[model samples]
Target: MEDRDWLILKTIYEEKNMSKAAQVLHVSQPALTYRLQQLETEFNTKIVHRSNKGVEFTGQGEYLAKYAVDMLNKLRMTKEIVESMENKVQGTLRLGVSRNFARYNLPPLLSNFLTKYPDIKFHLITGFSSEITDLVYKEEFHIGIIRGNNNWKEQKLLLAQEPVCIVSKSEIDSNSLPALPRIHYETEPSLQSVINNWWEENFTQPPFITMRVDRIDTCKEMVKNGLGYAIVPKACLTEDDILYQINLTTRDQKEILRDTWVIYRNSSLELTMIRAFIDFIKSIKQEGV
Candidate 1:
């Protein structure tokens, strides 16, 4: 089958509905149907069974979808290889980045990189660290930048380390933190556990949580408004903000820190674009950005 046919099949398999796939592929429903019919006729097998709810792939369809995905990946790699022979790093850099990092940090970094390599394009996917890690592991992204730690066995580099601190609108006695109306936010499990363990070690009583928010930025805003106190990574705090901050530490007095990491498969470094991107990130890290 042709490359376009593989793309159509892959899109259909992902969307699981002809109408949605047609919309994504920028093709009319009738045209998409005609193409599917042609494929079925050529292969002499039913690819998908239609229903009111959606379409379901038959066994042969499922196998063909997998084949299509492999073929597409090979084609992409081959294209990158051919382009790299010209000593040009011009291709899409697929990135999966943590939502918090994407919001707070990625803009300037990406802007600088783009300014330097105007030919390179980016496809960024923002999600939770766990989701980003999964995407990187699946090779869906050339690289992933995530907060906190993960069990990925890929090539990983520590991008940055920032202090995790307790922040409030005003200074308060250290002993009173356990009784204060603490603001909490949802974060990666590893970071949550670190905060919880720190609290457990410092005080016998649990935190008097006043509110729970979905994101760290919201938690910081609530603290900024004098609603309550929050413990967050240093990146959430601005240098000019007139807020009370207390850097946290383990019971042994080691700093409690949040780490940002760039993860990729070792084999992916062979691509000139991926290698250049990784080196760019390293340069950014060295510059303490």
Candidate 2:
């Protein structure tokens, strides 16, 4: 089938509703229906079945959608490689970045990188480090910027390391932390495990968790209001936050540092845009916590 037909099937598969797929494709519903009918007729199979709930893909439809995804990816990769052959570094750069790094570091990093290579276009997806790593492994991203120690077996560069600290409205004794009211926030499982293990090693008593929140910033606000204390990475705190922050250390006295890494398959460096961006990443000097 043609690229247009492939895209049609893919979009319908993603959107799951005829009307939603049509809107995304920027085509009329009737036209979309006609196109799908033509595709099904050419294949001589029932591709998708529509019911009152939504559209459901048949076995053939599922196979076609998977084929469409692979073909689209191959075509996109070919375009990137061809665009990179020129002297000008201009091509689409797909990236998957961790949430904290995307929030604190990526904007300025991308701004400067774009200034140097004005023709380069960026497609960035921000998520948990674990999710980013999975996307990278699936070849959905040219590069991934992630946090903690992700087990990426290919090219990996340590971007920065920031201290993990406890913040509160007022200074509290380090030994008193377990007895203090703790503001708990959800974080990636890897990092959460690290924090939990550290707590277990350092204290005999459990933390007196007073409240639970979904985000680090929400935990910070709770701390600012003198509600409780939170343990967060240095990236979450600012100089003007007006809070007391105590850096954590290992039992042997080394600071507990949270690491950020840039990960990619080595083959990606063959592209001019990817190569240039990696070189640029190497040159930047990130200030420490």
Candidate 3:
């Protein structure tokens, strides 16, 4: 059936009368009746039960009406998105981000992005790098900002690779502390394995973990409270007085560390807005920052 048929069905469902539905639609009663007849022919089911007082949907019509509403809503959204993309105008972008990037980096960039695309809306979700990457791979998110190197074979833009440092309270003597309590994160499997291997190679005794966490922000907080010490990307740090980095006389040459990346489906590389954002990220040299 045509779109006009759904509109007629919707109007009839709302107005509950042939004359009123036609009046509201600014169409003749006979035209509305013909449209409904065509839909009923298409579906091979009765859709309306007419009474002297008004009209109501039959069981089949009720079901079709519900589907019509949903289809219409989706159609409108699709039209808006397509038109906006074509016109270089506005649209909604669903984003999946690692929890750390969502907390540390997205604030200013989002602020600027919103200013530029005022009609655009964002749906944001935060999780681990792997979790966000899975969503991107599944096409659940149009774009993703995730921590650690991407191994998904998708194209990615490196956002920032700030210095990764160990943080702890002043009370924890960096030089003399015996088997310091290191905070651990559960998100990055590759990085976690690397950290474990680095710890094993560098020290005869392994540093004990005071606590394990799912998010780096919490790990930072735990370190600040002297609950433990954590190694995290330096972009998470502010020049504020609340947190400090641990001093190390000797560095482990084998440690692997870095920050997050912006990734999208390989097919999306041709989209203008996506390319624009990638260029903006590189122009800022976010990796160097």
Per-residue accuracy of model 1 over 1-289 as CA lDDT, tens digit each: 8999999999999999999999999999999999999999999999999999989999999999989998998888777778877778888898999887888889999999889899999999998889998877777788999999678787999998899998899998867998899999998787888889888988999999989999888888898899999888887676666789899988788898899999999878877889998899889878887
For residues 36-55, could you state the per-residue lDDT of candidate 2 as single tens digits?
A: 99999999999999998889
Q: What is the C-alpha lDDT of each candidate?
A: 0.89, 0.89, 0.73
How well does model 2 score by local distance difference test? Answer: 0.89
lDDT, residue 209, model 2:
96
Total clashes, candidate 2?
A: 0
User: Candidate 1: minimum summed lDDT over ten consecutive residues — where?
Assistant: 233-242
TM-score preference between candidates 2 and 3, better one:
2
TM-score (C-alpha, index-matched) for candidate 1 = 0.91
Segments of candidate 3 deviating more than 4 angstroms:
1-81, 171-178, 213-215, 241-255, 286-289
Sequence-dependent TM-score of model 3 = 0.63
Which residue segments of model 1 deviate by more than 4 Å? none
Candidate 2 residue 106 Cα shift, in angstroms, is 1.2
Q: Which prediction has the highest TM-score against the true structure?
A: 2
The residue pairs in collision within model 1 are none
> What ranking of all candidate models by lDDT puts the best one first?
2, 1, 3
